[model samples]
Target: MRFPKILLIPVLTLLITACQTGYHLTNQGYSRVQVDSLAASADSGMARFLQPYNQQLGQTMNEVLVESAVPLNKARPESALNNLLADAMLQYGQQKLGQPVDCSHLNYGGIRTNLPQGPIRIGNIYEVMPFDNQLTLLTLKGSMLREFFEYFIGNQAEENALIVGGVRVTIKNNLLTSIEFTNGKTFDPNQNYTVLVSDYIANRGGGTAFLKDAVRRQDFPVTIRDVFIDYFRQLGKSGKPINPTTDGRITIQ
Candidate 1:
């Protein structure tokens, strides 16, 4: 659901108008407008027309989806929010692909905000993951997977780290000392494993060129946001509050 930033204005306007007027928006045609040249002042008539729609949209966004037993914050190495998101991706990927996903990873930059300790709302999830990045599955030889972790460790920074799931990574002196699955199986260089990640990474975005070497790739139509939303809804229906915590999944020493 990625859209050019410039097109967002017109697309949002069409959505709001459709909601208010009961007229579906369609691809009629297109025209280029100099957005920078437009006047800064808000149009009074347009604002009045959009007020109700804005309120409705806001209400929908604010609807509570679930509750969190503890506040989840994103951080380097590991964090509660990171673990929750990565686990959700892993679970969703396995369910969607109808196969086991050895692991899951997400770029730290993709998560935009933190979740509060109480009720989690739809808008909160939207704020956390604004970009509609699709989930992708990659199958790689154990050797390539090891190389990927080495690169990930070498590039670690406060704002640049990968949120990981189903694996424990130990780093020493900025080197990946050891990596093993949570199930207690050590990494084997000859094995093939499936990893769940965002399409952005699969396409070699975020400077991860090695991802292009994946032995096999599968792109799912579902977005990461959709995955989280459904996960939260299921928890809500089951009257269970998410209580994610930071384990030693990724330890730096």
Candidate 2:
């Protein structure tokens, strides 16, 4: 999340220009301006104007939220980073709803970067989950839930397209052979279960159109980034470092 000094010049120029323009300007054809060594020496006013804002942004982004015991990287089927995010969503959902959540999930593509093994900063979380996707709660019959996974299994390519928590899935030959809840409860097609997912998926983004048919759905004002921040802060408060590990939540044979 480190902002390069060179990139900041163009951004600062835009900001200064915007501030100077008293009226809205219509967009027109744009051309790239080279920001080489010559351009670097040309703008003392812009540099002065950008200094404070840049410093403030840097301070905020660099604030340490928590520490990670191990480098959390994303991987197909299952990985420590995926497990950590899914588990965070599940725990946060349960706390927010004041009830047990059956499961939680996030699209693998949503994770943009990996966290290093040491201090996790606010910027790191922002880099990891850049989308402003909000958390959404959905209630679906077990049958509908099965359809959700079926779509995932059928559509997934070389990469693991999904990360899930509180549910174990066994896939073989591109088929979902079995699914079990970690709570030791049976998945009954007739029974309804609560699921936590991003608003993007609930709205049928990422090829999950079946989610639009959920028996019940609720959108929260919370964003996924904020949820991770809260979770990390809570861990910091408890004197715990992030040390997530894969638990075979999703297996392929």
Candidate 3:
């Protein structure tokens, strides 16, 4: 194609301008929309299509499982929520693995929220434990158990890093004075104990270096939240509220 100088210059300029570039808005701001009490239907056909899924999810999330007579909050040294969760893990692990669950450890951060002293729902469990971490039954030697406790006491002091079940730890001046089971059996450093822990700890997610030397480990089919839900149901069937007490499991002096 033949073109004049002015025509060629303009054509080249148009070709250069055709290059794609992203828009970088310097004054970006959020736009708020009021969905409630809106004047218009605002896509009613789409809403109809999503109505079934919304109904199913709402029903599942709202079903009351049990009542929490006491608020299950996370605390350093110990907590009622921690006690309830740890007990549930131990019970579930013991029954599922067909073995004596000597102790269980629930990562303090893993419990995302606290259970209010009221009706506990399926959604409440989901909110408290919102992870896919499964139940891991680990067979640890007595030495490993000691290391676990030491790591728990030293590193987990601030957030109370781990809430334990089955074992009681008495701390004096920030030192472990006595180590015994919640039932009064003393810990033996030379013996092997089966404990229930989350796969998050077993997989080294939350600074659980103590669990690295586990002698034997068994992974369960369910998750921590599932165990809680199942236990909640079981207790509800027996008319027991979801109330667990801090029975000096982690005594501080």
Q: lDDT of each structure?
A: 0.84, 0.85, 0.81
| Per-model TM against the reference | 0.77, 0.79, 0.79
Higher-ranked by TM-score: 1 or 2: 2
Model 1: per-residue Cα lDDT over 1-253, one tens digit each: 7999999999999989888845576768878765552646678999999999999999989888898888889987789888888988888877766867899888888899999999999999999999989998999998988777766667766457857888888888766778789756668889898889899888988788987778999888998998988878777886888787778788888
- Among all candidates shown, the one with the greatest TM-score: 2
For residues 1-253, could you state the per-residue lDDT of candidate 2 as single tens digits?
9789999999999999988947676876979998997777757898899999999999999988888899989987789888888988999988865656899988777899999999999999999999999999899999988888767676667343658888999988767788899888898989999889999889998767777779999888899998888888787776678677889888899
Error of 3 at 137 (Å): 1.1
Ranking by TM-score: 2, 3, 1
Of 1 and 3, the candidate ahead on TM-score is 3
RMSD of 3: 5.3
Instruction: Evaluate model 2: give its TM-score.
Output: 0.79
Best by lDDT: 2
